[model samples]
Target chain A: MSLLSLQSVTKTYGQGQAAFQALAGVDLAVEAGDFVAVMGPSGSGKSTVMNILGCLDTPSSGSYLFQDVHVENLDRNQRALLRRHYLGFVFQGFNLLARTSALENVELPLLYRGEPVAARHAAARAALEQVGLAGWETHNPAELSGGQQQRVAIARAIVTRPTVLLADEPTGNLDTRRSHEIMELLTRLNLELGITVLMVTHEPDMAAYARRVVHFVDGRVDSDQRNTPRETPA
Target chain B: MIWNTLLIALREIRRNLLRAFLTILGIVIGVLAVVTMVTLGNGATQAVSAQVASLGSNLLMVMPGQRLGPGRDSAGAPSFKLADAEAIRAQIPGLAGVAPMASSQVTVVAGGQNWSTTIQGSSRDWFHAGAWKLASGRLFNEGEERAGAAVCVVGERVRKELFGKQDPVGSQIRVKQFVCDVVGLLQAKGQSGMGRDQDDVVVMPLRTVQRRLTGSQDVAGLMISVRDGVSTSKVQQQLEGLLRERRHIADLEQDNFNVMDTRQIAETLSGTTQVLTALLGAVAAVSLLVGGIGIMNIMLVSVTERTREIGIRLAIGALEQEVLLQFLIEAVVLSSLGGLIGILLATGLSMVLADLMQVPYAFDPGINLLAFGFSAAIGVIFGYFPARRAARLDPIEALRHE
Candidate 1:
């Protein structure tokens, strides 16, 4: 069975006169430990696909299966549980809570999981260190550079040791050097921890870090290709 | 869960100290006004009741008029004489004591010091009927009272003004044209419920005030005390009937004199204070309601302001209730803290005002608890809609929100 699969899912926004279809009959499957990148134009529904996979949203029609369980039928709380236990998200904005320290930001997922403070602290510390931020644990987002803040966001995403990491435009706000550094971190996390990394990037160079790339056009997938990734940054 | 929510609430409050302080100030002023009004109201009521009670339990004042109050026009009615008091003492079966009371406002001079005070004239029975006790010395001797002698008992206020610290009991004071020796010092009873000074007086023999001061045989009023275990209302009815018969009032005509019950007077006076307190408390309640609306307004803006934060939390895995509880508890903690501060402030303010008004400082625990409970309820009521708005936001749309 596939790690996660979407079977001919269709999603529409609005109603009647102003209705707009964001996704039309999209079929996708992701294997465990695979790094797949989704690329599309601005209005091609790539982020919608990410939202559905992250369980922050559900498709308007058709089945979403995770490990042979139908995700479409899950209630809101159940979906939240799925997201909490199995998924992590990285947004373009690096949505770390303002004025919160890096370590505490990483500890947020564990806090929702109701873990003990000592364990959460230890795990958050390890996750921050894994993101190459061992001594920057106490720095708040405003105090950190954009690259460091994005790194903190990535650390926060992986702190729970999630099965799949969904990153949408993770390097969108960073310059080339910072973007390459974040992609390298993602590559290392995917290869070493065997986490399924599903990313959406507008930049071809950022997408080159993924082993597989899927391109979308006009709200539907137009191409899917596999390649040997550029493992080292220029 | 509660502890974590409380932590989040405290952090939010600390992060936005100025906004929180503004919200809290609204509640503080509201609660402070409410508590102070209630506390002081209760104190004034208690003071009134005490002052009325000090006039002697089950006491009645028979004023020589059909009408009562500020514009009491008693000129059309004949004043009561000492014979009326004697008649009431003889005819009323449940009587404890009676005094024929007459008074004249006079300037009393002692040594070089002079003070203007009321000189009340009545028999020795006036002590029991008017609830007067000797703080020092003694009441009139048989010769002094029976012969209408030139002797008097000076109340504490009159003594203070006329004789300073030296004992007035052995001193002489000039009333009108004649000098009278002070044979006793009456204990101080402070002020009456009507704001009249009870102790600012000199008590002389009835005939001395009638002959030497007023030059009349007429008494101003009758002071009567009912015996213990007797129903004062029943005695009042009997006293009324006896006076009607003595005054020769026709069966169809209204009686010339009016009977005033101390207990009834206490109820009326306290009722006035209670009404005033209710008015003030109502004003305060409106203020609290407005303060609650202010909280709602702030929370609404806060929910809007922190949409992105909420999006982040929801994305990470905060349940709807978690987000809801965070905001709700924040408002609760802020308002409740405001209530606590207001109660403390009200306590201090009420005490000071009570002292200034010369009323007892009465602390009511129920009111304090009720005020606290009300503020917390305000939190839950006003905090709900904004919290619900926060919880119901779409995570994707919220994330996209700038």
Candidate 2:
């Protein structure tokens, strides 16, 4: 069975004359350990798809199944539990808590999971190390550079060992070199840990790192293609 | 969950210490006003009661004329004579003592020091009726009281004013035109229930006062003490009837004399102070409501400012209740801290003010705890709306907030 399946999912805002549809009957499926990049222009509903897939939003119509559990029927709290156990998110803004240290930000998910202090500490430290920030655990987001802050955000996203890592334009704020570095980190996480990755991007170079690219236009998929993923330049 | 929320709250408060203090300022002032007013008022009531009690328990005072409104009668009522005191002492049952008293303001001089003080004259029974203790020397003998001896006792304040630290028992002091020997010194009784100094007087035999000062064979009032377990109201009734009959009041006429019970006076005076205390407390409590509004105001601001942070928390698997709990705990901590600081401030201020006002220091634990608990309740009552607002934010829209 596929790890995630969305069939004819639609999301609309407002009502009647003011109603706006962000997504209109989109179908997608992700197998385990897949690295898929979703590409589109602005207002093309790429972010909407990411939101629905991350369980931060539900479809106005149709079915969403995660491990065959029918996620579309879950209530708010149940969706939260699903997200807590199975998903991780990295944002374009590098949304690390402003005044909090890197290690504490990474430990946030495990804290919500009610992990014991010692175990959470060990897990968060390891996740930071995985993102190449071992000795920078004590630095706050404000004290770190933009690229380093994004690393902390990724560390926080992966600390829970989520089955699927959702990156919503994660490298949209970085320079070329830093963007390549982040793409390399995401690629390594997907290949080494067998974690599924579903990313949204506007940049073709970033999309090239994924094994599959799905192009969205006007709330519908324009093209879906498979390619040999490019290895990171050392 | 509660522990985690509390931790987050403390961290937030520490982050913006000034804002937190300013947010809770209203609560601090509210609690301080309530506690200080109540505590000082309690001390005043206790002082009033203590002074009234020192006048003697189960005692009654019979004064000429009715105590009308704020003024005494314009037509003078007939005064009591020595014979009336003898009649009450001889005829009444359950009676401890009866003494007719008359007083005048006089300047007394001794050893080149002159001081103006009240001079009261009565029989030896006056001391027993007033429960007055003598510090030195002796009260006048029966012969002196009967013969109208020129002997007197000075109160503590009088002694201090005229003689400094020297003993005045053997000294002679001139009262108006009469030269009198200081036979004894009365112990200090501090202030009266009316806030008048009780120990600024001299005492002599009633005959001496009537003959040498006023030159009339009449007394101003009668002090009557009843034995323990005797009902003061019952004695008051008997005294009223006897004095009315003696003064020739008809059946239709109001009694020419008024009977005042000291115990009832104490209760009435203390009750008035208590009511005033409660009024002050209630007025102070209004400020606490204002304080709660302040908390709500600041919490709303906090929710708006942290909109994006809340969105992140929600997206990262924080339950709605968790967000609500976080903001709610922040408000509670702020108000509770205000309560704690208010208590400490009130305690210190109350002690200092009570001392300056010459009243006892009365610490009521119940009022302190009540103020504390009420402040915390204010936080919950006012904090809920903002906290719920924070919890109900749309995660997608919130993340889009600038």
Candidate 3:
């Protein structure tokens, strides 16, 4: 069974003639240990798809089965539970809480799980170390380099040992070298940790690193293809 | 779960230290003012009540008419005299003691130091009637009062002014032009019910004051002290009848005097003070209400400012009740802390005022506790709406907020 699946999901905003469709009958599925990249142009509804997949938003009409449970029917609290227990998210903006150290930001997911501070701290340290950010736990997001902040974001996403890791333009704010470095880290985490990764990116070069590429246009998937050579050392 | 939320709240408050301080400041000042006002009011009431009680209960004072009667005003009005006091004492059945006194405010000189003081001359019974107590030496003797001797007893304030803690016993102080020997120092009487310092004076023999100070044979007022468990009104009636018979006043004519009872005066004064304090407290309470409103304003602002934070917590599986609880607690803490500070400051201020007014310093635990409870109540009352607003915020919309 797929770890995360969206079956004909659609999201609409407003009403009557003024109504807009942000996601239109989108269908996608991500299995365990799969690295899927969603590619799209501006206004192509890739962000809308990401929002739905992460459970940060709900579809107007659809059947979303997360671990065989229908996510589209889940209540707000249930969705929060799914997000806490199974899914993790990394944003392009390195959405670490301002004024918080990297270690504290990484500890956020554990806070949602109601873990004790000591246990949360230990898990956060382990996650940061996995991202090659050992000993940089005390540094704030603002103090770190672009790639380092992205690494911290990635660490926060996987701190809870979630089954799926979702990244929305993970390297959009980084330089080419830093972007490649972050992609390398994500690829390593997917391969070594066996965590499914579903990422959104506009760059073809970045998409090439994924085992599968799903192209979205006008709120629907235009094409889906498998990469010929997905394994490449950074 | 509670610990986490509290930790987060404390952290946020620390981060926004300036805002937190500003918010708490309103509560602090409000609580402080309320506590201080209540404490001072309690202290004042206690001091006045004590002084009134000390002057004796169910006691009546018969003062002379403002206008000279009988010989000057109406042909029927009788005059107040020392002889009237004697007649009242002899005729009244329920009477305990009766003492007539002549009083005047005059300059008292001891060596080069001269101080203005009220001088009262009375018999031996005057000590019990007016509640005067001697600190050193002895009270006036029948020998001194009968012989109209020149010996006198000075009050604490008068002794302090002239002698500067030195013993004034065996020393002589001049009352007007006549030198009177100070045989004793009176006890510190503190402030009287009417806000006057009861200790700033000297007491001499009634005959001596009549002879030397006024150069008149008549007394100014007659004080009748009623015995405990006796009906004061009955004694007053008997005294009035006797005075009329002694002075030969005709029927259908107004008596040339007013008999004032200390207990009645105390009740009237106490009621008046209570009304005044309540009015002052009501005014102060308005500020507390305003402080509660201030707390509400700050709390509302806090909800708005921390909307995103609320969203984050909600998204992470926090209950609406939890969010509401957090904000409400913050408000209560702020206001209650303000109340505590106000109470402390009021205690200090009340003591200082008591010293300045020459009254007994008093601290009432009940009033302090009431003020503190009032502050916390204000917090809860004002904090509700803001906390509700925070709890009702949509997590999705809040997350999207800037």
The model with the greatest DockQ is 1
Best by TM-score: 1
Write down the DockQ of candidate 2.
0.52
User: What is the Å distance of residue B399 in model 2 from its true position?
Assistant: 3.7
Task: List model 2 lDDT by residue over B1-402, tens digit each.
Answer: 777666666766776677688767767777787788889989999999888888887888888888645666727788888889988988778988888999999899998999999999998989998889999999988999999899999999999999998889999999877799999999989888777788999999999999999899999999899999988888887888888788888999877778888887888888888898889788877876676677667656666557777788878888888877877787777878888998999999999999999999899998888877887777666666755765676666667777
Better of 2 and 3 by lDDT: 2
Question: Model 1, DockQ value?
Answer: 0.54
Q: Could you give the DockQ of candidate 3?
A: 0.33
Q: After best superposition, candidate 2 residue B282: deviation in angstroms? A: 1.7
lDDT of 2 at B38: 86
- Note each model's CA RMSD in angstroms: 2.9, 3.1, 4.1
Report the candidate with higher lDDT, 1 versus 3. 1
Candidate 1 lDDT over B1-402, as tens digits, reads: 677666666776786788788778777777787788889889988998888788877888898888577766666788998888888888888888898989999999998899999999998888988788899989886677668889999999988887788788888999878989889999889998888998999999998889899899999988888888999999989988988888899999877889989888888898988898788878878877787777667766666557787788889887778777887787778888888898999999999999999899999898787777776677666666655765677677677666
Give the CAPRI rating of model 3. acceptable
lDDT at position B45, candidate 1 = 87
Over the stretch A101-129, how does candidate 3's per-residue lDDT look in tens digits? Answer: 89987887687577998999999999999
Instruction: Compose the digit string of candidate 3's lDDT tens values, residues B242-278.
Output: 7767666689866766677787888877887788778
Model 3 per-residue lDDT at B175: 80
lDDT of 1 by residue, A15-124 (tens): 99999999998999999999999999999999999999898888999899999989999986787788889989999999998877898789988887888889999999
Distance from true location, Cα of A110 in model 3, Å: 1.5
